[model samples]
Target: MGGAARVRRGAMRFGVERRDRPASERRAERGGTGRSPARRRCVGRPIAKARGMTHSPLRVAVPLGGTDRGRSGLGTWVQAVLPRLARRLRARGGELLAIGTPRDLDAYAAVLGEARPETLPAALDRAGASAGWHLAALGRLARRRGADAVLLPAANRRLSLGGPPTLAVVHDLAELHVRGKYHALRTPYVEHVVPRALRRAAAVVAVSGATRDDLVRHAGLAATAVRVVPNGVDVERFRPGRAPAALRAELRQALGFRGPFVYYPARLELPGKNHLRLLEAFARAARAGALPHHLVLTGSDWGAWARIDARARELGVRERLAWLGRVDAAWVPALVQEADAIAMPGLFEGFGLPALEGLACGTPVACSDTGALPEVVGELGVRFDPRSPEDMARALATALTHPVVRRRAAEEGPAWAARRSWCRTAARLDALLEEIAVAPGKAVAA
Candidate 1:
């Protein structure tokens, strides 16, 4: 294993904290006088109480899947939301159990040190098959541990846990609607497994209204079953700031880049993310002398990097292109702060977390008006049709040339970002858990 992987493995040795004991034991350990019957009823028993009863802390099980430790959008949201929910739930006299795959257990433990864990005995490489097995295992585990509710950060093949009512966070219905590309294989999984999971889940949480609509339209889920919970940002983590002088100097010297640069921080996935179209647009802008800025692409995967490099060379703008593959997450805010603008020409997204992150950093953004981009950004940034290079070139040119627009975006963007917070997201999640623990038959909380 590589150094990073080794470090991640070392971190998982420390086991996760779980609330597997009875409610009386938990209350006594915390120095409580006595556990109330209502509290005890709320802990391991089904919800069956008078309306408007005071809420109690619930034993919640959160399952981590898909990029749960990285700086990617989904990972970032999960990292922010889960711990806060755990902390808040604990304060309210409840407990949290975080379930993770054996492969990701270490990475997750590294990020969420004190959260309780129930490690799934399977690898994540085989996502579809592993998800089915893990879900069944999680159901049995939740019942054995007396968990009040279970949550999946991402979708799985099955979620029919015998113990607590289940919930899932569905980012989008991409595999159902968008076919004939890299995601073609996922069509079968999405069509067969996702609907069943949705049906089994008591509540379906979508990251954006667009995603909710997509799920209702394509997956045939009832609108009432889905709740729109937009993704949030860590305002303090990603704010307007200059790059550290030493680090900036080191990176500049290392990359041999000395001009203003347009930054694109996303995976180099083909088809959906559309890195080829971005390369084409950047080359056209460079050739026409319309843009004097260097293009900096920062992400993972060298195979995709080679393809983009060849395209840049074919367009004769290889000298103007720089690839800084996978930088530390701490440096992202500073790098985005230094850029003229952040560009995301993705063809689809569940919530477009990076766009919101860039905006939180007070950087102007130029993204395609596709998928959940418009929903996240609203009128705060510039947009273009992702399918056309000419449109992308025009949007890029506009962002580069218009100082007033950039300034306005910087002035208004942070406040827009401030509207969404992990704290609030957790509170909503807590409310849902309370509802499920009390009355599973009641329609899911709005």
Candidate 2:
């Protein structure tokens, strides 16, 4: 029995000896060093040296699969920044990976084309299923793709518990500030899940200083953890201009009766958007014969459409209110250009994008004094108390009747907006990503 055991052990030793040949011997048999340059350098090498060679072209995975169809504020950010961001990344031997459902890919096709886009399975298109995929499969996908980090542009709504070190963009804590901004069921997720996720991120980007402050104050995040990168407008696209005659004629016909109109392009939402108060203000101004311009409302109905319509009718300004519904995004700059004034009366805003767009279009802007509107609109905005119909009415009346206000906006608004260009936003974001990538114990090891 001992001799048989010795024989078995001898055979095992011989086999192991053959498999574990010397590196030189193996290399000779393989006809020279068999590993690729990257593999050769990486094998048994210091992680820092290996990382310096193999981690070239740093990759960031961006998972996007919500039903927003790239129409929300984040969507606008993506549209404005992605193309520029992609170019900058490529310049530095990095790439952007956009993974999303077919619908999402289609929604931002042009902007997304700048990145390496991969489509998620159609089954993961629904909201619940998509969220689950993001929670479960995102990390796996990042690993398979060798992504160095994950970039969640709409991190407030989408995030993963596990992934490459993450950079989360927090647009607002609107749910915490404005009651009923979202469904009651969703409020808890925002209150609990979102804050936890934001805390877990390697970095957090707030689109406005106000949003950054909210993150620090409400989310219990350290001020150092949050970086303020304000949203930017595509000044080239949203600059002062009239629609071509054909498009102008189309808009005129769509409105039925339109001379000069006051434009307020925001999602139709309640106390959050302050649409009701703005309607009341418009009604008051119209009734008092202080305002002659029709109120042009654009955007999809969120939850307050019925109330807004009812109030407009009740105030007897229904005819004066032209509900253009959600017009094409391409039509927005022209709509602003031809308007007598732009009104953004949201009670609370993280970054009042419409106000910025209006300013970019060289249109006189009448925006709320609260939140980021004042910050975004600067001295150009005719500020008003969003909660007070009287103040709103006064601002609206001034914007419409004051030719000096209109002329000054036409001259200065474009230049002011030019400073907040998408190019600058993209540069800041690129720098942030680079910093995150090379930070010790983060993405650099990957």
Candidate 3:
């Protein structure tokens, strides 16, 4: 579809009702300085401003073209952080120009009502060509808007060192640590291409301290250049005890599991996400009569899905397994709240969002002790060894059956999530950007 048509479609999809207005009024609303759209246009190019449009001190260009249809953990981070981050930047006499394909912009517009988004051609929507678009067009787009810096939210995937002054957010280095996380062809990009770009960035934001350490140790990035910025959850939206009984009933009926269940929200990928082992643990617990709750898995399939299904069947626990493929975002909070417990059996997690979300909903979480899960969950989660099914079954039992542990999680989870709000995250990010924008030369040198 054409870019303009996609924008219109996106606006319509989000219930952005259109109203006809005078051209001058529309121009005024868009911050144009009393000039007609045609008058400001340069014939061959799109016009961002009139002859005298006011310029914000700090204009940051955010590229979302490489973000995969707003799925995955990276997508969740973008949706949660960008709206708050945009508000923070605007409050300080700054502007955020989000660049993406029309569909991506549409997704952002749903959350960010006042976002100033520029559209890229739909051809860049393909995975392989996304980085090529960033390499060739991102800098030009930033330069057109006089952007002070470019913030790459998923920098490990899409990066352009030639851009104004790039600030990269590295979510995880899981592919480097976990074998078969990426295909053999894509492994080299994660190993070489991503690290090389991180080295040249003006500053790199690691989603967790564990990720920061990994960058320093494995990627050879300077510790000083890498800053640890943890991802935050929406406490208001994900708070405990608010989900209606109707919603819970609906969720239960949809999953075809009427009894209590353990919710594991993650992609069905092997070795890295470790769903196969989770199945084994579930079967072990079920057979021993140690666990009463059914296993409910929510996420899109990423290869190894067949293996997960086959393993469940072989273990004779397929009937007890509820695979709600790729759950809707609106249903996530209710799903978490209604579940008996949350399970994350990933081999390694840079920052375990499910653990945080589960805590926020007052749902007890049983997650792997490895990676940043320990750091995020702290004393709240029921930690276990991911490699051992015995340990996982034990943790799952505690989270589901232990009265004292469940009560403590229900009472304390909300407060724990409150401390890690998106507001605080945005403030920290604003400060970091301000520092880099204030002294670009020094930032680049470092």
Runs in model 1 lying further than 4 Å from the true structure: 1-53, 122-125, 156-162, 180-183, 441-446
Candidate 2 lDDT tens digits, 1-446: 23233223323321111223235322322323332222231112222342353334568888876527766777888887777777766765779998888888888888876599888889887777887788778878987898887888887788777767788887887878788787787678777777877777778888877787788887788776787777877766788777789988888898888677899988888778889999998887676554567899998888788999899899988888888888887688888888888999888888989888888788888888777777677667777778898777777766666656667778978766655656656666666665666672342110
Superposing every Cα of model 3 onto the true structure, what RMSD results?
A: 15.0
Worst 10 residues of 2 by lDDT: 37-46
Q: What is the lDDT of residue 117 in candidate 1?
A: 80
Query: What is the model-wide C-alpha lDDT for candidate 2?
Result: 0.74
Give the candidate number with the greatest lDDT: 3
TM-score of 2: 0.83
Q: Backbone clashes per model, in order?
A: 2, 0, 0
> What is residue 319's positional error in candidate 3, in angstroms?
1.0
Candidate 3: regions farther than 4 A off: 1-56, 444-446
- Sliding window of 10 residues with minimal summed lDDT for model 1: 37-46
Model 2 residue 347 lDDT score: 83
Write model 3 residue lDDT over 334-373, tens digit each, in one string: 8888888899999989888888888888888888878888
Score residue 252 of candidate 3 by CA lDDT.
70
